[model samples]
Target chain A: MTRKHLSTWGAVIFIAAIPIVIAANSPLLQWRDPVYIAGGFAGIIAMALLLFQPLLAAGRLPGLSLAVARRVHRWLGAALILSVFAHIGGLWITSPPDVVDALLFRSPTPFAIWGVIAMWALIATAILALARKRFRQNLRYWRAAHSALAIVIVSTTAAHAVMIEGAMGTMSKAALSGALCVALLVALNDLRVWKRTRPGRGITTD
Target chain B: MTKLHMNRRTLIASSGAVLATGVAGGLAPARAQSLAPTQSMRGGSNNYRPGAPIVERIGGGGFWMTGTVRRAGDGAPLSGQRIQIWAHTTEGHERDWHSHGATLTDANGVFRLEMPQIVPAFGQPHGHLAYDSEEFETVFLRPVMSSARDTTLEAHFVLQPA
Candidate 1:
């Protein structure tokens, strides 16, 4: 309904779509191709949007009209989910075993563990956000935890891209790095916003 | 005919399926011995001539894995351990190759491979081998040393927690 609500659903949809699409193919998929590239881009955008959602929700960015940011954030979250699905689906179709390893957190490679943990964290953060109203829990605690997880998501996703020996090359790495930087900046802005609201201990009530 | 003859006598009987097709010498053997396709008489009593030195060894597994591959006699790390591992289906018929396919050991004569439980069916050969969903298997280890060095190689196995 509202932009925040839409974004929330969008993020959930993305996370949920992964196993569905990967299982879509029987044999699985490969990574060295365009689908994966596009999916990577989409993932970056989706992460960017999810990170921005909080700032818009709290009315942090002034010039970038709060309403517009909220809308973009929602759409981006949906797009992010789509990207994740595409990334995993493409991989599954080409190399299902790799996807299986990634999903099960049994990948022998270094980045795989970080990626899996980040994925689970993203899902958890989304759920917490969605149920915030009903739960009546402390918003600050949720916000802090969400922020910490967001950092993990960005770093781990970047590491995933960086460590991939095939399919992803220089361009993908550059793009991933740039997007990560943007997410970091946006996160910093959100922190500043929260700080301004608190004006004392850097804890925002609203 | 001669190549085939050489393969039957020297390669299959002695090398154990190495050199898929070719061999070092074109010299035809005088006689061919009856050969059986079974895991018997490894190295044909030549007494384990080690393989080439391993340049690198990169091992990884499911968040945790540990093992040692060494030259059989001295118990020292076989610097050039050429270990190949594969997991097989419970029936031991099909190869879950895509998931638990062949893996090589690293320079320290050690390797750990983190494998996915499910495998994608590709053009993988039938009846190969793979890791089982319920259990793990240590497949193969061929230590590489020079012809001059008399060597023995053994690999230890470790499986994930059930």
Candidate 2:
């Protein structure tokens, strides 16, 4: 295989193996509750998707064009939303009071607070993305709002995953979370989304 | 050129700040919360069941949990039935938390488990016990509270046949 194809396939395999390895070692398997297992896996998948987002947005993935990356990024975003829904829904069915506590930000679990914040931020970002065309006249404002929400999503989700003790192994989870934060920081830096520009220059290419 | 250098330095500094905040926030010590049991805290239904009773013994201990397995309808002792028990101990590390074991009820349908002293951290002093058998629905009893002064806790299970 060509070197580029080899790299692409290697990356895909490596990414796919993360959750497989984590699920294999997870305590969820011992619990033997399908709903709980599904919820755990969904959460893992969402974190994995979050790792992909910045890479795609920053056009860092090898063998993929900017157009393909953007398309994949959009589709992945939708998949992330679905995964979050499944994760929360499964947890809700198993424990409605805990879910309510989480939503109300009164849960004693530190992870729940961060997870709820991230979920709401993710929903807001999705809504803003869907309503992009409505803000045609104020594209700059839309982009700024979108970027801010993206920051919240990444930050809070990373916090949520790191604090939880279940599912993903400690070292592997830490490594993935570290890589995610670095990728996001690099993407935001490259995009220069926060850089101040002349008043009339408008939004720079991202 | 100096302005460009300053901006680069600013970006690096801001990135470091953000990373520091994230890492610190994630690693913050978990605050203790009151032990409020939730529905989900009760183990899921998939692990529940009833079977013939058998006797099984666990460690000799700080606290004792003894119980009998019987049919809900007829009150007949379930002989040779399997019971699974797990609990958090006082000395266990946060990462290495929880103790577990399994045993069967004797001909008279009784089983006993011994637990080490449990120190309460995230919640109250409690443990989970499950009954698994082919003939009846699975039963999960969680957060079976124990007291520091009390040495023995009684936990009985009456199962409904499938």
Candidate 3:
């Protein structure tokens, strides 16, 4: 990798790892049960994965070729989905009623609303991806639908991550959330998902 | 390409500054409330029970949970409203069954319960109180004590009817 590529990768890794390291060292986690801790860490990991996603899709990350990047993106997507489930499931086990309230959109924290919205958007995007063969028929429509959900996921997840003063070290969490938004914005701008995406012309490795 | 690189560098540097500031400020200690109705908090339902036994006091008594329940707009005292209370305590974690209890407001809408001293948990010394009964719009309050050393933590609820 060139200096540019090396720096880009380093920055990505730096932003992604800082929160996990901080959260792992957080004293608050010592007071929490294993289930809550698992849930909390899964949430942190999910946010880090979000940072990789758009950069991968935009083929902006170092080393991985576009096709390889896209492939890794899919795998990471699966990992992201599973992490989200673990995050919610672990929390649900720890406190069913609170999780229920959050799922039902009655959670009192400002973060809960944003989290629920992002969670649903992520789920919806996953569902669409499953049936993306149909969407591949019309690249423009697929990009529109995918990009729209991506925006929702990016924005609301950022809101959700930042609003809660949780086990995650605050600064790293804020920085990660900020990077996630920037990654999505950069990806969207580079891909021009809102504009034409004629088949075979959507994603390319120049 | 240069501009994008500069942007990324700036982002990384700015984030570094934030991390430095946060560490200096004690790693973003626990704080804040809200986004709930007036005087009612959103996470109030945390550690709540629908019918925690109406106890003389929460177990391991030393701390007091005191508050007045009243109508939201008019401030009329709401008698007989069940206020569920729980907290991580010297006796047990708030998630423990024993650390939880309930009490009802008097004719004057005042309710008080004693429980074990609350120690700092999740980076703050706090207690949870909820008005989960159907009598009022449900409200949950997680009020942080200014100091864990304080013996009494009060949460006043001005609630709307369910």
lDDT of each: 0.42, 0.65, 0.79
Instruction: Give the alpha carbon lDDT tens digit for every residue of B19-125 in model 2.
Output: 78678776454343111111223332222223322334333357667787877545677888877765545434222223455677789989877766544322234
**Fnat, one value per model:** 0.03, 0.00, 0.21
Q: What is the lDDT of residue B84 in candidate 3?
A: 90
Write down the C-alpha DockQ for each prediction.
0.05, 0.03, 0.14
Q: The CA-based lDDT of model 3 is what?
A: 0.79
TM-score of each: 0.44, 0.56, 0.72
Error of 3 at B51 (Å): 6.2
Better of 2 and 3 by DockQ: 3
Per-residue lDDT, model 3, residue B18, is 63
The candidate, 1 or 2, that scores higher on lDDT is 2
**Chain A fold similarity by TM-score, each prediction:** 0.62, 0.87, 0.94
Candidate 3 deviant stretches above 4 angstroms: A197-202, B1-64, B69-84, B88-93, B102-126, B130-152, B157-162
- Kindly list the per-residue Cα lDDT of model 2 for residues A41-159, writing each as its tens digit: 78888888888787777676777777788789889999999999999997776556557777888765677889999999999988998988898877667767877888898889878
- Compose the digit string of candidate 3's lDDT tens values, residues B1-162: 001123575568757866886878756643431112334565566666567889998775988989988675456778998989998777766778888899989999899998888876533577898888886787778888887689998888877767
Please give the distance, in angstroms, between residue B159's alpha carbon in candidate 2 and its true position after superposition. Answer: 32
The per-residue C-alpha lDDT of model 1 at residue A38 equals 52
Sort the candidates on TM-score, descending order: 3, 2, 1
DockQ of 2: 0.03
- Candidate 3 interface RMSD value: 3.9
